[model samples]
Target: MAPLNSHSYHKVLALLAVIVSLVVTTTHASTITRRLETIPYLDYTGIEAAAREAISDTLKRRGVDESDLIARELLGPRQLSVTVPSCKKVSKRKEWRDLRYNEKKDWIRAVKCLQTKGDYGISPISDTLYDAFTQVHQTNWTDFHGNAFFLPWHRWFVWVHAEAMEHECGYSGPHPYWDYTLDYKNPTASPIFSTDPEVGFGTHGNIPLREIGQGGYKVDNGAFANLKVNLPIPHFLTRNFSAWKDWDPERHWGTALGGSFSPEQVKIALKAETFWELEAAIDGLNLTTFNDPPVVPSPDTPAPAGIIPLAGIHNGPHFFNMGDWNGPFWLLGTDWFPAGVVAPNDPMFWPHHTNVDRTFWRWQQRPGKQWEFNGLKGANRTDDPALPTDLLPFYGLGPDVPVALTLKTENWPMCYTY
Candidate 1:
């Protein structure tokens, strides 16, 4: 080929640059389009005073106005100076680190108090801490999961458990939580699961020959072991340990549903930039799991690409801690730690869920996003719809608590910070 002059060579170079720019712009536009399509949309409406006027009025008589009620309800009570001279009542929930030595002791005392107390009803379930959870589980298990109601429902559960510990057992301190992300690699090794007789959740139990053969074990140690828990029948608390393993059909579960159960997963949950992504990750898709529809991921599942991942955030720690899914496991009564009706059987369920609640509260702290609730509708069943005015019915907790009022972490009944 004949050599080109400098002017022609410069023209060629400019032409190449233009081609490259067009290609880049097209690729970027496609990426934005796919992301916009894939990202789930959540229609979260702010709690309206008109919708909750009745509840607001009731709270007003107790000295809480609408805005103050809403603010404190979602975030918990605001922090005030020692001598601020205020009459507002709020419940303060603290982390484990903040508890005094005596406070820890009192917590244990309160747990024991509930453990020994009378059952709400139903004979042998009796008056123990286990019974309370069992009652709530039995009553509301249908309402909480597989919908927008999941997060708020559990938030109410945790709050009332704290209330029971305080009122029935005389615990003066707020409910404490275990931030499992801090010890993500091996949760069993953490201090929260220490062998301490007082506060620890205890280590894994002796893996029975049956369980060991099938790759399962029990959490039968620490303070929780030998502690009576009443499920269908009275039994000692149990646990088994399993490090998070990424879901792969061939390696992890041999064709079961798949995903990673790692610290990174929790971080992904916390790092969600938008509320819709956060809710989808945490609560899964708000469709009915009861029908086992094809749209819903299979059991022990993660949403495949282009599908809305259900319970993506909440599923991590459950399976990670429950570990291997090889069958004949007694604690879970199945191959895995079922996230459904019976999960609260584990005492760790409380703290694990408390951490979930904390994450929701933290997400609320983000600007322009603090006050939010699910606005989506048209599920398979009308009963499962998520509405701000919907009541989170905790049977035997006296009156029905509205979802709008409960969104705040620190409100009239609950006054504390993370």
Candidate 2:
């Protein structure tokens, strides 16, 4: 072994400092929560009167009018400022700098919040497709064209966030979508100012337009060529899930047919890789893995596992790596590269994770495996030297309302392309 020199010792000390910083940063940070918000109604006195009238009218079998419905059911008085935690915005450079060495598991957790996790301060308007922010600029901190990786990743992040929020929170509200092409002028007229440097105001990615030139994908000018290319994925969950099988509950969910799964149901199952090959036909693909750089495992495991898996860093068919789980890793990447464009407003992110949640639902549909807990007798969350057979932390679709399924749940009433 080489002898330790003063310079080497200094470098070691610096690395340790970085590690310490990351831990402190994440520990103190707060997680964004999905708080439910109802759209504003004009007045309460009118609402109650109209509500009484509408109910009486319906009972009388007379056609109810929109004005009456608006005052009664649709419109209500604005209550207190209903706010939920939104994903933390790294509004300044200092926040980003702190993330480098002190964020801990948050490096991954934050990325999830950026897109699909939760909106801290926003009132819950939960529905299957309800996403909080109306503009890409309002969604995250990473520069869109500053790098190519974030475009797809951010789109996916937003996608998963919206779906998960609706499923978990059960806010039956408007799940609005934006038309990326009508972007020259503000399409959504979002409550916030809608100016994003990446794609102007309302422009979302043109996969649909680009593919069929049908709706928003239709471009009139020479601007299409100038669109940023994030390489591997143009948008989120654009990658088929079956490719990563490490912790592929998706496959088990689908295969468990008629309400039950195999020995994989106990939590803490050791996965060989990260994802699965659930939908190779959509993009014409196969089982593949992200060419992840190694990670240092948490102290609980070996240090070799790295803080998190760079699982999203794979052959995304782009100029760089693409990911699902790996998307979270990219959010925390110190590496440098350019990503793609139109990701800021990509609507595909919402639909994609709807499918992802659909997968989670399908998993629940699998009958509780009688054999799932085989070979292991006693185990607790704190059990040391745990086996793969140990169970994991899980709950029903809604924590408020735990749902069981003869089959998994659906993202929308319409998640049946497969």
Give TM-scores for every candidate, taking all chains together and pairing residue i with residue i: 0.65, 0.24
Q: Return the top candidate by TM-score.
A: 1
Model 2, 146: alpha-carbon shift in Å? 22
The TM-score that candidate 1 achieves is 0.65
lDDT of 1 by residue, 1-418 (tens): 1222334333333443343233222222110111111112110111222224333433333343353444333223333421212225665556676777677667876776776765454233455544756656655354565556667778877776776676667777767877765665455566777767777767767844243222334556666666655554444554445322333324332111223334555556566555545665665553324234333344444543333254354664555455222111233444332322445666667777787888888887777445456533222443323445345555443333456666666554445567
Clash counts for all predictions: 30, 65
lDDT of 2 by residue, 1-418 (tens): 1222334333333443343333222211211111133222212223223223332333223222342332222213322343222222211111111223223122222323334434333412322122233222222323221122222223334333434433544432323222221221221232111223222222223333312111232221121222322222232222122222333344331221101111221111122122121111111122232112312221122111211111111111110111221233232332211221222223333432333233333333445321111111111222122111111111111111001100111222112222
Please list the C-alpha lDDT of all candidates, in the order they appear: 0.50, 0.24
Stretches off by above 4 angstroms in model 2 are 1-344, 368-418
